[model samples]
Target: MTDFWDDEQELKKNLMNVSSTIESTVATAHGFIRPILLDHVQSVGKMLRPALILITSALGEQEVTEDAIRVGSILELIHLASLVHDDIIDSAAKRRGKSTVFAKVGAKQAVLAGDFLLAKALMLTSGKERGMDSRVVSRALSRLCESELEQDAGQGDFFISHHTYLRRIAGKTASLFALSCYAGVALQESEPTRQMLCHRIGYCMGMAFQIQDDILDYAGSSSKLGKHTGNDLKCGIPTLPLIYALKQERENGQTQLHDLLYQASTPLKEKTVKQALILVESLGGVQKAQILAESYKKRAFSDIKRLAHPQVERQLSTLFTKLSTRSV
Candidate 1:
């Protein structure tokens, strides 16, 4: 897929500012941890959350300011921190085709490095010029923690309903998306209605973004995704596609898929994982998840139209389309 920021030069410039801020912030860490933090920051993917902040902040009457850039950088730091923790939890060795902190430094130091990022992010938030609300940041972080706990607790639970799956992702992933959107407008716009609209737009976009990611785990290639396909299955995490597949199997009075999954070990055997992948595709799980993601994309599009700026609306619409249909 084409880079979403390719056609938008100004947004690209602003994103560069966000990147610089991230690097500079990481540079302040203790010498022992600084290189690791900088390594992860260099591999930051897409800067999607920061992009959302920059995009939505344009909806307001004021020009996009340094404050927006700084806030965007802060959110990206939080996102980076979360990825560090996530890699450790999944025991993932690579991310974005680079060695994960967990793989490079091991779990203990990786955990501290991740915490340092969070602490740095929080410290940045206290700056007097910051436009983003501290309460929103804290709440989003809290939701992220709770959702992660839910997902961890639900491991090997292939029986979870689709509703349960949605809720888990809403917290795990969507909360940051929502926060990015709201922070943009809240920093620039005074109208409550517009602020709320941006929040909803972000929430829908985030939900679609995450569902598509889950779908990719079952249907995408490792080279394209920058990680192994079927990694989620190997880790025994029941994402939407697998959840739907199990539901379909139950309807047909078939337990083959369930039995395969149940018998599979953590970091499931490759052969069994292959079998499970085929069963999931044949049962239409990937297609169903795609449909759900498309629905969210459409909802976000509808709201994007409600915004007054034609340029911002088109940019957002293009982003939503690319995100929903992305292969990587």
Candidate 2:
């Protein structure tokens, strides 16, 4: 298997265009919020969603077009907006090693700035080629909001089933990924089967991506992750590793972990937090979560193999493999 990034100068070029488009889009924001948005963009991550859009667009015969770049920009804006809101909700001061929007502007203006991004995304979507693409974006935005609300409601409630955790991530993270893959192919290919296949590939990959992220919360280094390990536990959010660890503890007739978790209050004691982190790791929570994430990665690879485009399949497979093991 050829390395996907090794030879795809074209894909890299498209991604560069997407980044430029994102910057230009943010630059159009009102004066008060424009600079803040620019700052947030400076610390952008891999732009995986936009990359998915461009990659899947290759499923069709057409060369990558401006429409794909434009749509990629729109998807990235929505993602950035969601992150801004998430930082506010998490009361997080840093993201990707930079001050969060909330930290820079406080919650009040941060909320409006996040909204500004969403509105701009919507405005960009309008007056373009409208059809299933637009509808998919709309539905994805709705799912993202609903999932956030659900997660918010479940905070401090560590008793949630792993199924519930999966459902939440399906909406929170997987929906945008599915939208990105579907939108790309839909723009270039009219074949429904191919479009649906790309969407499934994205969905499985996204699930694995998020599960790996949660696992990192327990097993990864704070500096590498650009945030502290066990931050999720501190926020009283029970992710896959913690959830699996709790189950194992219960099976062993142990409640120390449960007792500590149940007693977790806001501003959780540093001592208790450290203890909980130790318990989760010691009880195989991180290992169990790693296994589950690998399962999803395998599923994604299965779907990727089914794509008719061999080069695209190889690229998607390589991408999934890299993401499965990513540390940040």
Candidate 3:
């Protein structure tokens, strides 16, 4: 299957289309946080999750339904809204190479903007008071918020276990992704088998996607990621890669790295940070993480065979390959 970059132009075009649709939905100003929120929402991004939802929907039905579009759009809108809030917590200055709403309008304004987006999303999902998916989706959004709050509260706690980190990220990141794909399936079929397959596949894919994100945050640059590199590290969050390295360290490697990490939130010296990174890289942390991600992709794909065949299922299948090797 072709990778994401192999079809980079196609992906970009699809993203632009999704962005345009979302803007049309939420671009109006009720005098509160009008253009500021709109401009930030219009910033360039991959829009990969929504695209997956749509593709998975197509797998079940021959034609796209209005329900599918609305569901896909709402899923993405909620995800983006969460991002707006997350940037505030992380003190992120930029996203998609544009000044973040938090940077542009201050944290207070940014919070309002995020609230506005979320409120708008809720209204749309409510669908003129007869909203189709409001109940399930509202519950999902609440879960996502709780997950993020947990992660935020625990970010600085040195005692948080790896399992805690995994659960937190799964809720914060993978839950939305899972719902995106699950909603697609939900819209088309209520068959237990279909729903089960979609959930399992989406959950595993979400896990892999978040891990790759952790890997890139450390290994990639701002231009490629469209944000500050090592933001997580700087925030004193010992992510999987660093955590893995620390776990696998030789006696001295463990002591030195742990000491460097345990110190309260000072900017890790450049030389010291580089050594830690090198240690992580040497201990097979990056490789091990990739292996775990690949296992998720493999497990996700393994469930695909259980579903009835459709021609467009290929695109859904391609998503696994594309995500595994995507560059940006």
Candidate 4:
């Protein structure tokens, strides 16, 4: 099969317009939000969710012929809101190379902005009706928030078990991906089977995407990875690869690894990060994570098969490959 990762070239240009809207939405993000919404945490962000929704919406149609943009905007609002609140919780400074609102505007304003965006997103998701679509979107949003809370409460142990780490990221990140794809199908008057396929496939691919992110943080360059390469470690996040690697070590070995990791914290030092990377690779942790991601990629392709037309289908196929391999 032809590689899909590089195929995003055209899609990127097409979605450039959509991203522009997202940029505008984020700039005005604090305007409609509560008084607490401020500038530090508010700015245009990468329209990742919107793009995902739009692309998925395009699945059964030609070009951007469908109402994918509306669905994309709706998801983008929710995503921006989530990031606002998440940055506060994570005490993060930079997002997409800019200072996060929470770090600049103060937590209270940043948090309220998040709430405001979420409220708007609620209405957007409702559209003309407040029936199944509202319920589905609401439930997914709630789950996504709960996932954040779970991770916040987590100990961030390097030796943390693999299953829990998967759950956290999947819930926080994958849930939104699934919701966007589900909404894409719902709005398009697509088949129920196709809707189900989009949701499952998106979820699987999202999981792979998150896992790949974790791997690259340790494996890629500071410039290429952007932000901090081991930001996950900085946040005390123990992603799947690290967790699995720790599990494979002996009890004393696990203890030593955990000590080394926590003492270093996330975006860990280059030398220390290198040592851990070597350790994880030695134990097949990186391979295990890659294998899991690849499985999801295959599952995504299977789901794409449920949709009709070769062009759109091929586009989705290419996106999944790129998502799994992208540098950042």
Report the lDDT of model 3 for residue 102: 87
Whose lDDT is greatest here?
1
Candidate 2 lDDT, tens digit per residue, 1-328? 1133545777778877887877887888777678889988766787788889888877777765788888888899899999999988888998877889999899999999999888877777646652255566678788899989898888788789989999899999999999988888888855888888888888989988999999888888889888888888887788998889899999999999999878668656778879999999999999998898888788888888888788788778777878887887
Q: Kindly list the per-residue Cα lDDT of model 3 for residues 1-328, writing each as its tens digit.
A: 1134355455445555666667877777566467777887776365767776666665554454556666666677888889899988878887867788888888898888888777766666645322125465666677789988887776655445578768877888777777776776666665656765776777888888888888887677668787766667776666777766667774444576666667745345566566667667877777777888888888888876666665335666776777778666
Better of 1 and 4 by lDDT: 1
Q: What would the TM-scores of all predictions be?
A: 0.96, 0.95, 0.87, 0.81
Cα RMSD, model 4: 4.6
Residue 325 in candidate 1, Cα distance off native in Å: 1.3
The list of candidate 3 runs beyond 4 A from truth reads 1-17, 30-32, 61-64, 126-139, 250-253, 266-272
User: Which pairs of residues collide in candidate 1?
Assistant: none
Clashes of 1: 0
Model 4, residue 197: displacement in angstroms? 0.9
Q: Between which residue pairs do clashes occur in model 3? A: none
Model 4: per-residue lDDT, tens digit, 1-328? 1122244665555455555544455455535343334342234434556656766665553444335665676677777788888888778887767777787678887787677776665654435631126677777878888888988777455666677778887788998888877766666667777777778877987888888887886676776544776666666767877876777666435565656775775545777766777777777677778888888788888878867757658766776776777776
Candidate 2 TM-score over all chains jointly: 0.95
Model 4: colliding residue pairs: 4-318, 36-109, 40-101, 41-101, 230-267, 233-266, 234-266
* Candidate 3 lDDT for residue 128: 38
**Tens-digit lDDT track of model 1 for 77-177:** 98899899999888999887889999989999999999999888887775554455667667888999999888887776667888989988998889999
Candidate 2 versus truth, CA RMSD in Å, comes to 2.5
